[model samples]
Target chain A: MKNKAALIFGYNDYALEIAKNIQDEYSHIYIFSLHSEEDILKNKSDFEIKSFDLSDKWDYISENIDLENSIAFSVLEDIAENIFLTISLRSSFETLNIIALSNNKETADKLLMAGANKVIPLVQTTAEMISEMMEKPIVKEVFHKILFESGELKISQVKINSSNSYLGKTLSEIDWKVKYGVIVLALVLEDMNSEFIYSSKIKNHIISEGDIFIIVGYETDIIEFEKIIGSRINVHWSHWSR
Target chain B: MGFFSRLIVNLAYFINTSDAYQRKKRFFYDILENNRYPYKKYFDIFMMTLIFLSVAILIAEVKSEVDENIEFFNTYVISIIFFIEYILRFWISSSVTELIINRSEHAAMLGRKFSLWRAILKIIKVKLNFVFSIRAIIDLLAVLPFFHELRLLRLFVLFRVFKLFRYTTSFQTFVSVLSTKKFEFLILLMFSSIVISVSSVLIYVMEANNPNSPINTMFEAIYWSIVTISTVGYGDITPYTSEGRVVAMFVITAGIAVLAFTTSIVVSALTEKLDEIREIKTIDDIRKLKSFYLICGYENVAQEVAQKLKDSPIGIIVLDEDSKRIENAKKDGLVALNYDPGNMRSYKKIGIDLSTQVKAVLCLRESDVENVYTTLTIRSINKDVNIISLLMDDGNRKKLNFAGVNEILYPKGLVGIISKELIGRPVAFEVIHALRNDYYGVNIEEILVDNRMIENTMYVSELNNSRYRVILLGIYKKNKNRFFFNPLDSTILESGDYLLVIGNSVFIKEFEKYLHKKIRT
Candidate 1:
C-alpha cells in the first residue's frame, strides 16, 4: 500500500505544530497556504508545500494527492475560512478524514456541519498552559510519555525503614537504575525537606530511616524496589475517590 | 388443563392485550418518568394542582359549617381519582419490571426461559411489592375516605400531601438531603422527644393540684409542653406553681437550642445538596461540548492561556490541586475542579474517558515534574488524546520526549528569538507582525508546487498577473536545497517545490483559485 499523507491547509503556528506532531505517523506531509513569510519558512524540512485555496473545487487536490488514505487538516487561522475549507474538502472526498480548527463552539459546530471528521479548537489558554507546563518537571515527563513514549512507567514513593539494610547509605550505593531498572526522581528527608534525586545535595546526603524516595519505573520494578525498601505509595495517579 | 390454570393463562393474555391497561401504563410512565418523556410538564402541572386541591379539601373538611354536597364531592370524587391513580401506578411499576426482564436475557437468567404461568406469577409478585411501597401507601392514604369512615381516618388526609414529593426535583432533593442527615435528625428528634415528655410529666405532677394551673390533665400537659418547647406558647395552658414555671422556662430554652441545632444541620445539608446540583449541571455542560481542552494547573501561564480561550468557542475545564485556585478559576467563569490532578478518578469525574470530547490535555503545572506525571496519568486513562507540555528546562526534554509530549512549548526561548528579530531585522519583524495580526491586508503564506503547477512553470510571471496579482517572493527547491528569490519569468517550477508569496487577503484567495483551476481536456 502507498504511504498515508497529511495535508495541512493553512500556514500558521498551529498548522506548523500539528504538522510536526503527526509527522511521525504520516509518510508524507503537505502544507498549503496562499502565501508565507520567513517565520513559517524557517526550519522547514521534508514536508511538501503548496499554494492553494480550498474555497474552489478541489480539482488540483483530487488529481495530485491520494484522497483515500490521506488525512486533510483544515487548520485555517480564520474560522470562516476554516469552515469553508472543511466543507470543500468533505464534499470532494467523502471518506477522507478532515480535521479542522475552530476558535469557538459555534464555529466548531459549523465545521461539524460542514463534515469535518474532527475539530481541534485552538483554545486561548493553550499558550498559557504550555508555558506553565514547562516549569513543572513531572508534568513535562508525563506529557512527554503520553505524547511520545509508551507510558508504561509509574512513579512511586517508598519510605525507608530503620530496619532496612540500605538505611543511612548514599543513593549512589543503591545502583537503582542498573539493578532495579528504576529511576529515582526525587527524595524527601525525615525533616520533610525534599529535592530531586539527581540534585547535588542528594548525591552525598545519606538516606535516613524516615527518608522518602520518589522513583519512576515499570510497575513491576517499582513493586520489587518497594519490597526491598519499605512499602511504597504512588506519588502520582493514586486512588482519589473524591 | 385444569380450570385454574386455563383461567390464569387467559387472564395473563388479556392483561397483555388490553388497550386501556397499556394506555394507563403509558400515562403512569408519562407522569413518573417526567424527566425523560415529552408533555411531562402538563402532567406535572395537573398532578401538582390535584395534590394542592386535595390538601385544600382536607383543610376545609375540618370546618364546622361546610356545605354537605361540596364535602361529598371532595371525599368521593377526589378519592376515586386517587384510587385509579394508585392502581395505575402499581400496574406500571410491575409491568415495567416485567418488560425489562422480557427484553433482557440477563435479567431473566441464562439458558432458562420463563414459562407463561411463571412470568405471570413473577409480575404479580412485583405488583404486590409496588402496592405495599411507601409511595403506594401514600396513594392509598389519599383515597382512604372511600374505604373507611373511622373518625380518625380523616387525619390520614394530611399524609396525601406527601404525594407532591414525586412531582418536583426540589422535593426529591430535600428528601435525599434529609435522608443523608437522618442520623443527626434522629438524634435531635430523640432529644426533643425525651425533653418534652419528661418535662410534660413533671409539669403535670406540679400543676395538677394548683387551681391557677391551666394544665389540668396529662394530654393538656403534653400539649402545653410541646407548645412551650416549640416556642409557640398559645397561652391556653400555663403553670402557676413555681416548679412548673421553672420547668416551662427550661422547656422554652431547650426548644430554642434544639431549633438552632436542627436548623443549622438542615441548612448545611441543603447547601451541600445545592452544591451537588451545581456540579451535576457542570457535568451536563461538559457532556454537551464536542471537543474541549483540559488545562491542568492555574498558574500565571495557564491563566493567560485561559484568557485567550475566552474568544474561542471551544470549552475549557481547568484542573488544579488548590481549592482556592479552583475557586478563582470558577470566579473567572471557567469550569474548574480542585482535585488530585494525577488521579484517573479526577479525570473520570470530569468525564474524561477513552472516547470523550477531551481533544487535548495541556499539563501546565508550575513544576515540570508534576506536568510529566500528569501527562502520564492522563495518557494511561486516555491513550490517544493529544498532550501538550511546557518544557521548563532543557535537561528534562529527553524524559518529557519519552513521556509522549506532542508539543513542547518553550515560551522563553521563543521570546528570545522574537526579541532578536524585532531588534535586528525591521522588515522581517513587520512580516512576522503581519502574519500574527489579521488587520494588515498584505500577509505572507506558502504554497506547494504540485503536479498541476509543473507545466505552468513557463508562466511563472503570469502567475503574478493582475487578475490574481500575488507577488512570488521566493521558491524553495527541495531537490537542490537552494532558494530562488526574485526568480525571472523564465524560471521553471516542478512538483514538490515551495513558493513563498506576499499578497493582500483578497489577492491571495484569488491566487489560490487560479492555482486550483481544473485541467480542461
Candidate 2:
C-alpha cells in the first residue's frame, strides 16, 4: 500500500496554512489544484504537487490514489466545487476523512451535505486570530508566563474531597509549590461554576468538598498533588507528559 | 393476492423504503411538517378563515339573537372538515407501529410471512400512539362541535383556535419560546398568588368591619388586593380606617415592586428563549452540523470573533451571564444565550451534546482565572472537545493548558506582535491591512487542483503567460510541508498542490469561471 497522505485540494493561502498546521500528523502531504496547474508547478515547494478536475470519477481517483488511508482537504475557493468535490469523494470513499473550508454558514451547510467531515470557516479564524493579537492587554502580571517563564510545566485540576485537610484554607495559607508541588490556578464550585482564586468573588471562598482546583506542576508533581486533593481529572491536555 | 405478497407491498409502502414511497413521504413532510410550500401556506390560510368564521358564528349564537339551526349547521361543517384533515394527516404519515416494526432487528427473523391479526394489532398500536399525541388530542378537542347543544361542551370550541397555532410557524415559535421559560413564569405566578392572598387576609382583618369600607368579605378583599398589586385599581373598593389605609399604601408599593421585578424577569427570559428557538429549528439541523464553536462570555474578544464569523458560514453559539450582552449579540445577528455558561443544565437546554459537533469552546472571559475554571468544567463535561481559552494573566497559561485547554490565546502577546509589525514594516503592514480589510477589489484566494488534472503538468510562468488573470503568489507542497514563495517557473505540477493566488474581484470571478469549465470538462 502507498504511504498514508493528507490530500489538500486547493492552491490557496488557507489551504497552505492548514497544511502547515497538520503536516506533522501525516506521512505524505499532496497539494491538488483545480484552478491553476502552471502556477502550482512554478512554486518550488519541496512537497509533491498535482492537479485534478472536480468531475473526476471515483474509479479514476481510486486507481491513482490510496483512498483508504488518505485524508482529504477540500478547501477550494468555490463553494459549489468544494461541495461537489466533497460529495464525490464521500460517495467514492466511505472512510476518507474530508475537511472542507467554507466562507459562510450557508456554504458550510452545503459542504456538510456534500459530505465534508469537517468545515472550517476561514473568515472566523482570521477574525479570531487578528482579534487575539490586537486586543489583548500587556501587563507584566498578565504576560508573565509568555514573556518571562519557560519550562516543561503542565496544568491539571483536582477535586477537593471532604477528607482533605486544606478544606477551609486560603491560597496564602497553603505553600502550594512547596507542600503540594503544584500551583493552584483557580477553583470550580460544586454547582460547576468556577472562578480564579484571586478574583473578587472567590478570594475568600473557603475550600470545600466537590470544589475542583485548577493546578499546574510537573507530571510527577501533579500526580503527587492529585493524591492530596483527591482524584486528578484526566484533563484532555494531560497527555503533554506522554 | 397471497398474504405474503400483500405484506411485502404493505411493508414497502409503510416503511417507505422504496423510491415511490420515499417521494410520497417527502410530500407529506413538505405539507405536514412546516409551512414551507404554497400548498401548505394556502391550506393554513383556508383553515384559519374557516376557524374565524366558525368562531364568529359561535359568538353570534351565544348572543341568543341568531338562528341556532344555522349556527349549528356551520359548526358541523367546520368540524367535519377538521376531522377529515386530521384523518388525512394520519393516513399519509408513518404510524408509530410501522416505525418500530421497520426499525427492529427482529424484522428479518420474523420472515416474509404476514397475518391479518398482526396488521390489526399494528393499527391498534398506532391508533393508541396517535390518540395520545398532543396534535391528535388537539384535533379531537377542536372537533367536538357535534355536542354543540350542551352549553358546557360548546365552551371547548375555544380549543379549536389553538389548532391554528400548528399551522402558523411564528405562533408555534412564540409558544415554544414561552414554554422554555415556564419555570420562571410559574414562579412569578406562584409568588403573585401568595402576595395577593396574604395581603387580602391582612386587609380583610383591618377593614371588614369598617362602616365606610367598600371591602366586606375575604373574597372582596382578595379581589381588591389583586387589582391593587396589578395596578389595575378598578376603583370598586376603598379602605376607610387609618390602619386599613396604611395597609393599602404598603400593598400598593409592594404591587409596584412585584410588577417591576416579574415583568423584567419575564421580558428577559422571553428574549433569550426566542433567540434559542432561532438557533435550532429541528434536531436534524443540529445533527447535520459538523461542529460548532461554543463561546462563553460575550466580552470584547468574543464580540470581535462573533462579528468576524457573522459573515462566514461557521456555526457559533455565544453564552453570557448578561442578558444585555446577549441582546447586543442578537442585534448583531448571532446565536447567543443569556444563561450561566458554566451550568450543565443550560448546556443540555440548548442541545449542546446532541452529537459531538461541539468543535471547540472558547473561554473568552476577561479573567484568566475564570477562563481556567471554565476550561476545567468544559473538559470534565466533554474530554474530547478542543478548548481555546483566553489567557488574561500570563501566569495562568500553565494552569489553563493543564486544565485541558488545547489552545491558549495570549491576547497580550498579540499586542506585542502588532507593535513590532507596525514599527518594523509599515509597507508590508499596509498590504496585510488591505487584505484583512479587503481593500479595493483585490483579494487573496486559495485554489485546489482537481483530480482530473492529476496527469497534467504545467509550470507557473506558463499560466501567468496564459489567459489566467490571477497572480500566483506562492505554492505549498503538502508532504514536505513546504511553502515556496515567489517560486521559479521550472516547478513541476503534481496532484493535491495548493496555489495561493491574488487577483481583483472581476479577475477572480473570471478565473473561477475558467476553473469551473476546466474542472467540469
Candidate 3:
C-alpha cells in the first residue's frame, strides 16, 4: 500500500495554514521553505521544514515522497517563483497532483500554462464577495460548516462506470438529493469541461460512462451513493482522508 | 419708551416666538435658498424662464413697437414676480426680529437696561450687510425694472441675467473656480493696471499734439490703451506720431504677456477645479438615481462587486479618496467620485435619501478603521441604510459589528479557509470557485418568495425542476431567520422565505419566470 503525503512549497501564512489543516490527512507532510537556513531556524513550525531553491531539480522530492499518491502545492508569494516551482514539479513527476495559488487572473493563467494541475486565483475570493454570499442565509451556513466545522461532510468526485443503471438518463429525471442523500454540485464531462448539475446545458445531458460527478455529503452517504450508482471515487488516492 | 417703539418691540417678540411664522419662513426658505428641496428645481426653472422672458422683452423694446399685451406681461407680471422673489430672499437672509428679541433677552440676563436705539442700530447693521451683498444687490436691480418709467433705472433690468448665476450649478462652479484664483487674479490685475496707466499717459503725452491722433484726451488715451492691451485694436484710435507708434508697440507686447499670464492662471485654476467639478457632477448623477449600490472604496473588492452588479438594474456609485482609483472606476464605466468615504459631508454632498435611495452600502476599504468610520458615518446619516463592511483583521469584526455594520466580511479568514479546503478537497474547491467566478457559466442565486407564492400555497415539490432545470439548494425561512439545507420536498414555502438554487444564468432566469407563472396561475 502506498502512503499518502502532501508537499507544500513556501513557508508563509497560507503554507502554514494548508499544512496544519491537512496534517492528519497525510502520513507525512513536508514544507519546503525558500528562506535561508537561519530564517527557517528562527521561525519554527509544526510541519517538517526542508529548504529548497528555485533552481533545484526536485530529485529529493521524488526520492523522499511517493509521487503517485501525493499532492503538491506551489504557494510561494512571488508569482514567478511559484510558476517556476510548478514547472519543476510537473517536469519531475507527471502524475502528481499540483495545486498553485496565484494572486490574480494573469498569474493564474500563467501558472496553469506552467503545468499546475489547478490554479486558485486569490482574486476570486474577496471580502465583498464573502459579504454578498453571507447575505444568503443558506449559503452562509453551508460555507461556515464547510470551512470551520466540516464534520463528516466530505466532498468527493465520483466517476460513473459502464454498468451503471442510470446511464443515458438526464439529470432532471432523477431526484438525487431525495434518493441518495448526496448533493451533486457539478458534472465533469469527457472533454474535461465542467457544468453545474442544475445548468440548462446539462438538464438533458445523458449520464454516460466516464462522466464524473462532484458531490458533497457525509462519508457514509457518499459511499452508499457510489455503490448504488455503480461508480467509484475519481481520485487515484486509495484512502479518502477527512 | 414711546408708544410706537413699545408696539414695534412687542411685535418683534410676537413674530420671533410664533411657530406658524417660523414654519412659513422655513417653507419659503426651502423654495428660495435650499438647493436640495424637491420643489427647488421647478422653482429655479420657473424663475429662469421669467428672467429670460423679461430680458427678451427688453431687447425687443429697443427696436420694435411692442404689443400692449406683451408690454403688460413683461412690465407688470414679470416685475411683480421679481419683486416678490427679492422680498422673500431679503426676508430669509436674516431674522431681524429674532435678533432683536435675543439681544434684549441677553441684556436682561446681564441685569442691564435694554437700549432700544442700540438694538435698532444693530438690526439695521445686519440688514444693511445683506442689502450690499452681490446677490442681494442683483436681486434689487432685477426688481428695479418695475420702475420702467425711470428710463435710467431701466438699464438695471439687465442684472436679471446675472441672477442666472444663482440658478445654474455650472455657473456657480465657474464662479467658484475663478474665486479660488483671486490672489493670482489680483496680481494680474495690478500688473495690467500699471501697464495700462503708464501706456495711456505716454500715448497722451506723445499724441495729444498731433492733428491726426485720436488720443486727444486722457479718457481717449486710456480707451486706446485698454483696446490695444486687450488685443481688440479697433483701429479707430491709431497713433499718428512716431513716439506714440513706438509706445503702441510696447503696449502690444505687454498685451501678449498679460494675455499669456491671464490664460495660464485661468487654465491652472480650471485644472485644479476640474476634479471637484466632476465629483459634483457625479454626486448630482447619484442623487438622480432612484436606487443605487454605494461602494465606498474603488479597490479590487469594490471593482469585483461593481463588475458583478454592472448588468443589474440598480445603479452603482463608487467613492474613493484616491483620485487615481476614482479615475480607474470612471474608466470602467462606473459613476465614481473622489470623495472621502469616512467623511459625513460626502454622504450629504451626494444628497442621497439613504433609506429610500441607497440599495446597500459596501465599505470595501483596505483599512478596518476606514470601514468602521464609513459605517458609522452612514449609520449616523440614516439608521436604516444596509451597510456591509470588510474586516481586515479578525479582532476588528466585533468593532465593525458594534459600529452598526449589517454584515462584516473577513477576507483573510475566508482565504485561509478556502486554501485549507483546496488542500483537503481540491475538486470541491474548484467547483465552488467556478460557481462563484462564473467560470463554467453556472451561478448560485436567490429567489424571493413573495406574497404571491405564499397565497398559492407552494411547496418545494411543486417547483417543476424538470421544466426549469434548477436544483433547490435550500430554503431560508425569514420568520425563523434559519436556513434549511436540502429541505424536504413536502416543506411548504411561506412569504418572505428565500429560495436558494444553483443553475446556469439562463436557467435561473427561466426558473424565476416559472415561479412567477405559478403565482399568476
Model 3, B1-521: lDDT tens digits are 55765677789989988999999999999988897799998999999998898889888999999999998888788889888888888888899898878877787799877778888899889888999999988988888877789888778778989999888878988999999999999999999999999999999999998888777999999999999999889999999999999999999999999999999999999999898887777677777789888889988777777877777787888889999998899999999888898898877777778899888899988789899989998888888888888777777889899999987776655655665676656566667766765676787788999887666647887877646667777778989887776778899889888888887888889888767766535
In TM-score terms, candidate 3 sits at 0.88
lDDT string for model 2 (B149-171, tens) is 77787876777888888778878
Q: Give the candidates in order of TM-score, highest first.
A: 3, 1, 2
Candidate 1 on B141-242: residue-level lDDT in tens? Answer: 878866537878877666677878877766776788878888889999999999999998999999998888887899998999888888888897878989
Question: Runs in model 1 with CA error above 4 Å?
Answer: A1-242, B1-43, B56-133, B143-157, B270-274, B284-293, B313-315, B339-363, B366-521
Candidate order (DockQ): 3, 1, 2
Least well predicted 10-residue stretch by lDDT in candidate 3 chain B:
B411-420
In candidate 2, how many Å is residue B73 off?
12
How does each model score on TM-score?
0.48, 0.40, 0.88
Q: Per-residue lDDT for A32-91 in model 2, tens only?
A: 877556856675666567778877555535765666556677877677778888888888
Residue B130 in candidate 2 has what lDDT?
76
DockQ of each: 0.04, 0.03, 0.39
In model 2, where do residues sit more than 4 Å from their true spots? A1-242, B1-143, B147-159, B162-293, B327-333, B353-361, B377-386, B415-434, B439-441, B452-462, B465-469, B479-481, B486-496, B519-521
